[model samples]
Target: MVAAALAICLRQRGLNVGVMKPVETGVGERGSTLSDAEYLRAAGGAVDPVDAIGPYRLAAPLAPLAAARQAGTVIEMDRILTAYERLAAGHTLMVVEGIGGGLVPIGHHFNVRDLIARLGLPTVVVGRATLGGVNHALLTVEALRQRRIAILGIVLNHTAIPSGPSGKGPDAIATRQGDSTVELVKELSGVPVLGPLRHEPMLAQAWEAGLGKVAAEDAIRTLADLIMQDVP
Candidate 1:
């Protein structure tokens, strides 16, 4: 979803963009069955082929190491780096969404942070702007810093906020005034907040009406603009 959103956002700005999911699992059709590469192809107007975009396709929905272990396959770190290079070649910017959280294991000997460090890309954390979000986002930042990864910024994704009382909806409303994501982010410090994302009506409506493609491009473009604002 992040990849698709980013693609739509960047495409709107008329920039060529690519996405890399070094390890993917539990994909089916109806978009759910789709591989990360396929999602990029559908959401990213000018996407590379699936094989060229994503080189590792695991079979389960668990951690890559666990999944690979179950399948009796090895998750190669060098292969991931090579795949990333293949997807990144000739592109001004590439959005690489790691599987699971920042600490999730990718191979027997490495995790997401290792990938980030090896890639040497400025890191941005995409998080839910909800109750526990501050904790999760902060911990993520701290962990990355501990690993010596350059922390870029935090993008609190409002789209993933829970709606009920269990969620941060009440808090977000009280603070954000039901307007922008910026208000919800003033609660944190350290990293630059970048901006908040309002749920795009066109996107929801398109998905609900079974016409996601109608607004997919526009949404991708909008997100791309937001991402560009923070690029150094």
Candidate 2:
């Protein structure tokens, strides 16, 4: 969700947002629940075909390289770029969600960082808002920098509720962890940091509807404004 919510926020701002996952693993066949790409496309209000939204759907719940190999396929950066071009053709902006992390291998030698460099689009790194967020977020920023990829900012998303010892109130440990993660990442990231967005349990059950609930939050709106600043 941070990605899906960002897409919705962009759409709400009147940007014709095109979303892509490019590669998705752990997909169930013909399920009631939508895949990540589907949820993103729906949230972004993109009319692009699902094929364009996600060119590779792997069955195994593994990293891209391993999943593609298990599926007897190789993820071609060119293929993904082609699909991206198709989606970007009509939309004013595109939101391409990265799988795993920047160092994740997609093919024999190419990684997500390579793909991002090839796409030539600025990125927004998303990391967990719980403990260890600082390490993950900083590693990603440095990894992308190694490829000279433009990073717009960082977003620390709250994927789980950090319950305190009492495990009662919403603000228990969640507030402290969120605040610490956000501040640490911001101070050290060398880029803007947004969110640690409130945990929305409904997101897991209802992707689109759950995102609709927080699409207008201060962080999402601030991130959208930051993105729009680069819109020439």
Candidate 3:
């Protein structure tokens, strides 16, 4: 959803942007399902072919390696790289979304970290803005740094509503923990905390509306501007 939101924000700025998912698992039922790549393409107004947007589409809804194994296919890194090059040649900027986390295995002996290193693109790590988010964000940042990936920044995405069933906002515990998570992730990772995005329920509404509703908010615009500043 963050990827889609970012794509929308970039498009609103009149940039020729393209979105790619590289590898997608958990494809929904045929003829009625839109994958992440599809949503991104629509959101970014991308003209690239579907194959270029997502090189590998797996059905098992697992890690790429496991999903490919279940389907009796192997993920070839060169294939993905070739597709990326082809897609990159056509766009001024490309927003490539990775599957799962940094350590996720895309193929035998190759992980998301390896893919990022190979692509040689600056990355913006996205994590949930909830309890325990600090640990997850910091750990992912550490792993990326260890692999020498250029991290542009971090985006703490608020994916859930702060209010609970009782019609009250987040409890004291959650609020305190979330605040600490944002501060600590920046301090520990030594990367700019690009900005915090408020939960945009419009995303789901847009999806349900068949991508007709392009959700744009202040947070999305802010993050988009930060990304543009980071882009060389």
Q: Compared with the true structure, what per-residue lDDT tens digits does model 2 show for residues 99-178?
A: 99898999998998999999999998888887788899999999889888998888777766645676675656666776
- Best model number under TM-score: 2
**Pick by TM-score: 2 or 3, better one:** 2
Which 10 residues in a row give candidate 2 its minimum summed lDDT? 162-171
Question: What overall lDDT, based on C-alpha atoms, would model 3 receive against the true structure?
Answer: 0.80
Which residue pairs clash within candidate 2?
Answer: none
- For each candidate in the order shown, give its overall lDDT on alpha carbons: 0.67, 0.85, 0.80
Q: Tens digits of per-residue lDDT for model 3 on 1-232? A: 7778778778777778888999999887355768888888888898788878998998888889999999999999999899999888888788899989999999998999899999998888989777878888899999999988988778887656456557777666666777777888878879878556766565554573422332355555667787788566
Answer with 1 or 3, whichever has the higher lDDT.
3
How accurate locally is residue 183 in candidate 1, as Cα lDDT from 0 to 100? 47
> For model 3, what is the alpha-carbon lDDT of residue 144?
95
Q: Name the 10 consecutive residues with the lowest summed lDDT in model 3.
A: 208-217
lDDT of 1: 0.67
Which residue ranges in model 2 land beyond 4 Å of their true spot? 29-31, 170-177
Rank by TM-score, highest first.
2, 3, 1
Question: Which regions of candidate 1 deviate over 4 angstroms?
Answer: 29-32, 159-187, 199-232
Instruction: Please provide, for model 1 over 1-232, each residue's C-alpha lDDT reduced to its tens digit, 9 standing for 90 to 100.
Output: 5556666667666767777778887644235445666767666665577876778776676778888887799989898888788777857678787777789998888898889999988777777665566677778888998988876667665553336567645444544533333444455547766445555445544542222443344434444555687656
